[model samples]
Target: MNAPARLRVAAGQATSVPRDVAANVATACSLVTTAADQGARVVVLPELFLTGYAAEEWRHDDSLALDASTGSGGPDERLRPLADLARERGVTVVASAAVRRALDASTLSAVVLTPDGEVRAPYDKQHLCGLEEQGFFTAGDHGATIVVDGWELGLGICYDGSFPEHAASAAAAGATAYLTPAAFFTGSDHRRDLYYAARAIDNGIYVVFAGLTGTCGASSFSGGSAVYDPEGRAVARTGADDPAVVVADLDIAEVRRVQDEVNTVARDRRDSLGHRERLEVGRAG
Candidate 1:
């Protein structure tokens, strides 16, 4: 079924408690509640939010990784609250964490909990950065897109958004919006915004960023979570240095207008260099 032209989404920016899944999950639940109260049907949170973004510190801590073992499909007990919240609020929640069956097999993953209380296939971060590459996370092999309210949302992590092809693949896979969970450091807002805006304009898709805020380990996050339209305009954004949520309505009509009249990047894309593979699509139950 096709969703309406407009869908309201929320980006929740907050700090994670170092290695404390309980506290972080509690905060995430609160954010979901707040976003739902504001009528947002989809809510996004920061990268590795289950445990604060301290790759060097928790890199080898097996206890910090959420269980992603593929067997009898059961949601991680620690994250059951989020699934329950999603079901109760009728919202799709995108949140990230380090997940693995073992320490060496860990991946930084974005968990998509839908309104039906199912933990969909998690989108693993495909691009690993400095500390993340140093034995902390294994890069994902393919991209993931999910259906929420009939909108195809492409999933990306912080570093993944830096590459143009990453977002392009999602757009090629029929995604109208790219949802990113980022843990951008303080003072990198310019680069962050540029990357997001460029990706949006390049693919003619909305770019939604949900960032970490406050201090964590040796890094401080100035939350500049935002939503950029297909034309790279800032539709909505949150303030810095604090926990906040920004809600915006994403209209497919704008994307259609841009692709049809303004930017013709999609039509100009070549199959050789441009993305050709359709991303695995998970539909909300």
Candidate 2:
């Protein structure tokens, strides 16, 4: 018989520090260590966690602008310690940081760090909101995925979660779980919860959304870190504006069962017809 595929994951709702890389890294390290101690094999953090989600701040500061890591440029020096912690604790961590893509000097990206301290797949935000466009960060070309503990995981940032294509492409790529690290602001909780649940139901996969809480600069984050099961059920969740680590144990077999039962319907399609049409148009372009 195949080994039972069960894993315990943690969603870290942290307080981000705008323009403070060292302090943010320190907080992330501490959170990872704490999550590992709690037997969390996989820990997910919020988007642009290291430098907070203050896109406006990056626009004015030269230091902050120069500090972004190009997704392919490997890990940042400040984040090396967290990588070391992951190696030491044997926990697979998914954290986000403001990254600069070397290929296009005009773009800043979000990256995922693997357990072995290596830069895993990078999912640039395809949807930029408000001041993000003014910050000069270009969108990513395509979505990406990572495999951990017999599970295919998809990566997306805050705004990326707003788009169905991001999660749909990952599911089509055989991802059983969708992981999003976000810094969603106030009044956005309802939308976040709705999207997460909708994504799970539509794709027949688990959705884990880790968000930042508390205030950073002029923005206040709505901390509703959540984990949705394959059937669009929120198996684990935290209250609004709470800073805590939410843990959930997922059974991969249930995901398979749900897909077989609910995903066979035409309405539960893996590829939306609209998305397919767009892909065809882009290819022909």
- Candidate no. 2 TM-score: 0.85
Q: Candidate 2 has which clashing residue pairs, if any?
A: 69-100, 70-100
Candidate 2 local Cα displacement, residue 265, angstroms: 4.6
Model 2 lDDT on a 0 to 1 scale? 0.74
lDDT of 2 by residue, 65-89 (tens): 3334534533556667877788888
Model 2, residue 146: distance off in Å is: 0.6
Number of the top-ranking candidate, with TM-score as the measure: 1
Q: Largest lDDT belongs to which candidate? A: 1
Worst ten in a row by lDDT for model 1: 63-72
Error of 2 at 238 (Å): 0.8
| Pairs of residues at least 3 apart in sequence or in different chains that clash in candidate 1 | none
**Estimated TM-score for each candidate:** 0.90, 0.85
Q: Assess the local accuracy of residue 62 in candidate 1 as a C-alpha lDDT between 0 and 100.
A: 47
